[model samples]
Target chain A: MLDANKTIQLSHGGGGKEMDQLIKSLFFKAFDNPILRAEEDAAKLQLSGPVAFTTDSFTVSPLFFAGGNIGKLAIAGTVNDLAMMGAQPEYLSCSFIIEEGFSIAELKIIVESMAEELQQSGARIVCGDTKVVPRGCADGLFINTTGIGRIIMPNISTQNLSTDDVIIVSRDIGRHGAAILMAREGLELESDLTSDCASLWPMVEQLIAANIPIHAMRDATRGGLAAVLNEWAKASNVGINLIEKAIPIADEVKGLCELFGFEAHDLANEGTFVIALPREAADGAVEILQRYGHCEKACIIGNVVETHLGKVVLTTPWGSHRYLDLPQGELLPRIC
Target chain B: MLDANKTIQLSHGGGGKEMDQLIKSLFFKAFDNPILRAEEDAAKLQLSGPVAFTTDSFTVSPLFFAGGNIGKLAIAGTVNDLAMMGAQPEYLSCSFIIEEGFSIAELKIIVESMAEELQQSGARIVCGDTKVVPRGCADGLFINTTGIGRIIMPNISTQNLSTDDVIIVSRDIGRHGAAILMAREGLELESDLTSDCASLWPMVEQLIAANIPIHAMRDATRGGLAAVLNEWAKASNVGINLIEKAIPIADEVKGLCELFGFEAHDLANEGTFVIALPREAADGAVEILQRYGHCEKACIIGNVVETHLGKVVLTTPWGSHRYLDLPQGELLPRIC
Candidate 1:
């Protein structure tokens, strides 16, 4: 048993007795699985065919926030990457870099949160490493999760978008970046303006099951919807005409953006995603997406066009158009 | 092209135009491959059969070290984990969490170092993520590498040791820890004492190719030789009798251990590993390992025994015997 009065020490990450105890008592117990319990340096996975491998490091400040903590975000972020690639989220590797004196109870809560989030996608954290730095050597804690999944659908790519494709927004965007900003500023907004940080595997899985010919699907993470759209436009060498009025944005998020002098399109999102597929499948994809609780505001926001190659043209409600270029400056650090 | 005069900004990790430029101009160029060039959310890999999955986060202080930098360490560490499981090093995902204002030149050097090290195992970095935190939120930069490999020799586990198995040390112990200590303490020992931080995939591949029936193999990383032997003992429920005289220790490492009041077996070894196999294969395995320049010090160090189950006993040169316990407390932080 770990002492309540004691905090994380350098010894806990030294790969010896203390590390063994910490791993067995906390990580092993929380992520109890046959593969992980095998206790080898690496996890032996029985994977076959094509697999999607992705990695992300989460250094979100204020480990706990409005909707989810870093642990939940870590699992969802990497799993979502795999899911967006039309793969079934299967296995994850969680690594932690902790600062000395970090609270054990908080660590436990964060770890439990990871286990809870893994249920959404059935992704097991099979292998992990923990390293503890001395005080002030790092922030509270940083987590890196790498995921590998079996690709159920192949060739869903950023470069696959064509002029016949219609772009759809999975949900209202910018909540994740707004929520992190609010948390950092210690804002007490009376509205339920939580970060839209949830596992996106469920919605992606549904889209795959429905046999939607998804051309490209990406979560609008750090640079938000604008980044994904711009990258898609450039990669596919097609023009994207986004209907600004049709894009979903929560009132609270808009208000925060107004106050912060930022654009909702440029804000980060954890759960929100953008999909490009043929116009015929657009309505069906939106219909399936809106069935999910978090994706109620899903709608068709844009369509691919032949003109303005490699550019995203946004038409405002006032009928004026502007190039929705890739975001340039930093909107919010550590949003994920 | 990235401006040579500018340092890394938060926008470099913001998933915006700046971030994409940084990744393409630096990471993509250094780790160039068709899969990586595709720039999908996740890398699509065609893998079959049983595979090994592993992850490691490198937060080693002094990014530049005696023998290698953090980039080399990150690649080698994760690759070695897969190799230890008798897996052929294949694909890797590298994620970087950088502090704002980190030197671009340093980053380039580190990345090139990673590319250089990848040649040892022929593993390609297939997918990655980059995040930049605000200044002071982290050290200069922390790298997390997750690897996937196909299993060549399955069921090589820490729990597979038997009384008939003999243990062999790959090389001299404690060089990594001693090197780090020397660098940190600014000790110019009039001796060429560099870290043993080379990739072990070549040696591991040779061992597998030679048809060595390796029961278990593990790198003496964070907790070093003592930790590996103790873990093998407990995991297999077999006693290990170690010949202290036969365990190779460099003179400089011995001097450092004496000066720091530490045991050589308790210090970290980045490139050294221990192998447990049947006594009949011990000489063959050692010969194969010694063919490599770094593994010149390879020798048999111990043998599994029936007495003192789950314990490691050391026989000293003077005929004195003692229990070699698993390391406890903070031996040295960030020795990796």
Candidate 2:
């Protein structure tokens, strides 16, 4: 009878034994925290001082496709975002919008993958909400993860921005973009282009431990470096000048961009970030990120400039200049 | 030049001006919070002590149908969950899973409706995330809202079920069921059987303000009152005896149940709740809830029993007894 107990079914959502099995064997096995294992309707936590809060939704298509599926992405995405602000990743609340006909086995696999990600990142999904839609309302599965991180760091930032900041990227641009192109385009490429998706908090903690005045940082997910650079420029009311040759891009991405009439710069990136640090700490920040897996290709891409307000200009390989607009709309949809 | 702006396109998810227009005209107009006004990456809040955190996803079919649409449902669903816990609804994070080829006009309408609900409920959307799927992958749109409320009341319990506790429902059953059935079944019933879906936090706050020992509470959504009752019965390790004849169900729902082979008790409800209160506080709780729009049909449907453990039985109108098992599956598949 126990051997016959199989994967999840629609009936589990019906709130029966199937639901119990899914919760016990699947969710519980993957995530077992005292607060989560309490099996309460909500999680209760005691907070002391200031808190840094963040949330994100992942709707990457082909739920179990190449690189990593939606489940792993959901955990890493929110955790990495919190880490960017140097917040200790603590409790996460998860919600799923599932289409009715999605296979239960696939759901289990995704959950298992997420479990591995959560374990490595030291985060617990304390509460979760699930909703199923008719076949049409949603893609196979869409996940929303809301994270709560305690501000253990004394001085992260309080809207402090200045002109003497150098912009540093944790890693090479377009590895995630190149990998998505290979997977989405169904290519058999010689280059081993895998997504650089991993937690950045460890690297962030290392920098914080080093006592660097990291002004502001953003994970370059959707619009890549262009979107994040332009956003920081507008927020801090400064300009960014990029040395096109100094910026990192894989040869494969450049090739793919040429084939699809797309610019590699505008493609989506998941693992890297655009960080503004003091000009003096540029060397130290670059060295720290280089030691981490996420930033093996780390480099000083550019710097926050005092001159042109709200403008991000890229120096072309030919040594001329052009204004880099925040790619008006999404380039490759749901790359995250 | 103004007329050149025609409608929403795939690029809106790409984070463009049309997306800005949609947010400014629909969302910002309704949710005017300082954090959202700045449109920053995350919402920053300064606070102390414990916080109540909750998240819910809305994946109703056709995005825009009868009674209320996805937008209002998303806002109302999260706000109501927070209210059930005796928390003051404060910050909300909204995430959207939008399908390719969805009508721009429909998306706008849903956002506007959700915004209106937020304003009415006094909750602000502090952050937002958006994702888009390919054309055949999704129906139209799905929304997930994560809610965080400051825990004003110190001690509230999900395991507060005692032998002498009374189970009180906020209002009539199956209003949302009837509305969805009409929309899906294309029935033209000449009745104002609109969904009972409004924010329930305000209704809950009115009751909590009276200083009553609220043992357990839940919004009778997806699986309805029976499921919640079953959960309480198990959590509190007690038996529940509910008289079927005393339960309040609309006449129209009863009629529809007869035709569709659906049980009035099993039908999904959107804007209702079942609260387990101290035996002494039952009368006061009922009186307070009735003063609000949600509990006009409120009643003491059942009482907690000390003898039998983890069981919920109902006395039928015909003097027969049946174990009110937790719902085994979706009653109105994807009704929410």
Candidate 3:
């Protein structure tokens, strides 16, 4: 029997005695549920009607960082995708790729974090798979989470935005990207700046409950605000005009962006999200968003326009207009 | 812009122009479907009632093998899990973790294989995600597939076996584990031994249609027959008595197992499966299984017993009895 207190070994994933022990002691205990305990090859779920399904692989370097680790990110990333589609986050499948000689203690820590994060959205980890590769075959760990949820609000899409729709950002942008850059570069900042990685299902559920006529909702992750705006413009075939000054940015994020020569809008935000809705519902949505602890900075940022179809134009505070092109090149890899 | 002819770069996973181009030109063209074309963060599916959800991560080395590649393995592994639960494989979420600088041509080949494999089970790759890590951060590629299906036969579990139940092997076993070992060791044998890595859903669907009164069904993957039988014994609190001479094993697999000092029962088999059915239905079940191409060698191998609770007793040809224990230690890592 391999001691999980030590490093993980190939036997722990070999589907034998050690593997069974590992799963029973670690996984089953952490993600205990009647369905999982049934020991069927698959988890039996009772879901109906239109359901949302999404998958995300988190290979973030420095597995642990400010605010969250890869495990939390894996859960939040997939759950947020479902929530963004107006789905009530429900069941999730977690798969881990662990390198041999990795610390089992660290694995437990990560798994605990994942279990804790699931409570935020009331989603359960129903099924999971674990694979261990030889050392050097992979980095410490990579997690893949696939989520399934019931669609509470239908027809929310990138192509749904139309003229006169107002855009509102959930919070300040670029924190996640900036935090990762700081961690990789080993920089010490005076401020308490951390990645904005968090589960967004609670807020999304509230929005759905409020009966807001949300046209579309998306979390600005990789390629950041710029990427989301660009994709929306092209998908909906509408021009988006952004008041640059209205977009929220923390001072530390701005400073980091200035130092790295990266646009704040092009930096990812894990927890932050953007919403498009009719102008009549803009204030009510923003008012509802302000109640969340992280959404205090939520405000209107942009709106749909007729000019420059399939384009995004940003007006600077100094009254200069510039086209916000889709982020190009490798700005920051593994920002998630 | 990153050229598809060259190696994959960071931009290819950056959620930018390159990523969009790769998804459109490669993935979209390969797995074309209406649900996937909706372009939402999550795929919308209309699933109702009892659904089977399973997940698997394929980290097999030498991405391509004699019988299948990681792509095919990813699809078949998850699909088989759902099938084992007597479910109709429906939706799959594919997430890839690729090393930067990996060949784009190879990725396309893998993706095409995945698309082709999906046809066997009529499962669609509805939602997916791609992440590229820095070089050396991961092996060539790791695929995580999570599947969702409607359960055609419910309550099939490991704990469902009763005394008059008979055990049956779907076909000859151990080919998959042997083939992988030979490939990794660079062995050249005259015999054409290929992996038995295949989609088992079609045959499983037949069994369900035929109404074999299945108590349990599981693919003998890692830890092979020994693991599955032991799991069944312990879960059901019953004993399993196997006639060693009756279990089928291919010549090449037996040869490889002997040379490696490994037991054929301890070796893995991807396509092969085991079933526990009522004694009266045993011959009918075997007849149905043998009708399939790969299941020509399917036969009755064992039966449930009241003695030796939570154990598997093997009856050799010499009238000798021995315990068939769960595999211990690492037989072969990354054999999936």
Candidate 4:
């Protein structure tokens, strides 16, 4: 058993007895599964058919946040990428690069969060590697999760969007970015603004089951909704006309954005997603999204148009329109 | 075109125009492939039958070494893991967590090295992610690679060893560890002592093609030869009797081991591997290994025995015998 006060040491990643103990007592126990317990160089998996493979490295600073930590984000980020591809999140490979002298107890909490998040998508972490660097060689900890999942609903792609497709927002935007900012600044906003860092596969699975004929679906991470819309516009060679008021944004997130001189649309969100489907299926998809507790704010925010191809045009409440370019400069570093 | 004098900014990983430009100008161009060109959230793959899934994160200090750089090690390490599972190396997912202000020119060189190494195994890097942290938050750069491949030769496992199974080493050991140590300590040995870092899939592929009934095979990496043998002995519940004199070790590595009070067997090797198979197939495996110029020194080093189950016993040159225990403490940090 690891001592509560003990911290991670270089020996823990030395590929020796200490590493063995750390793996068996901590990692193995938390992520116990038949495939992982097989103890092979690589995890043997029985995968067939077409699969979606993706990877993400979580370097979110402040490691811990209001709604999630790096561990939960690591699992959700990669799983969400697979889910956005219309794939059934199945397996994940986790690798950790830890700084020497990190708390073992804190590490346990982070690991347990990963195990808890895996249940959201039924994605098992089958194989993993750990490396510990010298003190100051790294921040607290960084996690990389690569996922592979079977594609259940095919042909959902950015290029599949047509002029008649309707754009929808799953929920409020910018919560994740706001939450991390608040945490870093040690601000007590007196409002319950937590990161929108939840596993999106559950909600996506519902959409697939309803057969809404999804064209393109992407989680609004990193560069957020603006980036995704711009990429989609260019990939599909269609214009996206978004209604500024129709897009959902929490008052708290908007307030934080104002204080920080940032745009809510450009702020990151871990759980929010954008979807494009035919106008006929838009209402059904929105209805399905509304059934979920977290996605209650889901609504149609825009529509695809043939004019101004490869550009995202946004109409303000005052009736003026402008091109929403791909985000420029760094809004926030290490924001998941 | 990226400015050669520019350094990587936080915006390069901010999921914005800068990130897109960096990826397109460097990563996409270097690892050019149709699957990667699609630029979906995940790479779409058509896989069947049992597959191997593995992940490794490389944080080796110095970044550059005598024979290979971190990029080469990152690719070869994960690909080698799949290859050791009797899997044909295929798709790889690379995620880079880079420190802010790192040189763009150096990043290009590293990315090119990764592309060069991929040619050896014919594996394509299909999907990836990039995250940049603030300066002082991380070392220069860290790479995490996750790979998946089809298991062409199945049932190669650690538990498959049995009595009379001959143990064959692919080549001399401890070069990687020694090379890193020399580079770190600024030791200029009179002789050429470069890291034995190379891809092992091509060699593994030949053995599989030759119909060698390989019971088990593992690359002697982090914990080195002693770690691999000890793990095999315990996993297979069989004793291993190694002839110390027969195990090949380069003179420079031996001299360094003596100077540092470290054992050659306990040092790491990037490309070297140990194989366990029936005695009848030992010479055939050695002959095949010797066909490769780098593996010319391949030879049988030991055999499985019933006498010290779950333990490895080494017979010294003068006939003294001792238990070779699993490596303990921190032999060297970040040697990978």
RMSD of each: 1.5, 2.8, 1.5, 1.2
What DockQ does each candidate score versus the true complex, computed on alpha carbons? 0.82, 0.53, 0.90, 0.89
TM-score of chain A, predicted model 2, versus the true chain A, to 2 decimals: 0.92
TM-score of each: 0.97, 0.93, 0.98, 0.98
Model 3: pairs clashing at backbone N, Cα or C within 3 Å: none
Considering every candidate listed, which one attains the maximal lDDT?
Answer: 4
lDDT of 4 by residue, A128-230 (tens): 9999999998999999999999999988998999988999999999999999999999884577999999999998999999988999999999888999999
Model 3: per-residue Cα lDDT over A1-336, one tens digit each: 335589988887887667778888888888898877776789999988999999999999889878899998988998899999999999998888899999989998998999899999989999988899999999999999999999999979999999999999999999999888888888735568889999999998888899999998999999899989998999999999999999999999999989989999999889999999999998989989999989999999999998899999999999999999988788988876
Least lDDT summed over 10 consecutive residues: which range in candidate 4 chain A?
A184-193
| Residue runs of model 2 more than 4 Å from their true location after superposition | A1-9, A64-66, A134-137, A152-161, A328-330, B1-7, B62-66, B318-320
Q: What is candidate 4's lDDT per residue for B1-336, written digit by digit as tens? A: 888699989888887778889999999999999999999999999998999999999999889887888999999999999999999999999999999999999999999999999999999999999888989999999999999988999978899999999999999999999999888988845558889999999999999999999999999998799999999998899999999999999999998999999999999999999999999999999999999999999999999999889999999999999999878888889987
Q: Rank the candidates by DockQ, best first.
A: 3, 4, 1, 2
lDDT of 1 by residue, A83-199 (tens): 998899999999999998999999999999999999999999999999998888789999999999889989788899998799999999999998898899989466689988888
Deviation from native of the Cα of residue B203 in model 1, angstroms = 1.2
Off by over 4 Å in 3: A1-5, B1-5
For model 4, state the Cα shift of residue A168 in Å. 0.9
iRMSD (Å), candidate 1:
1.1
lDDT of 3 at A240: 98
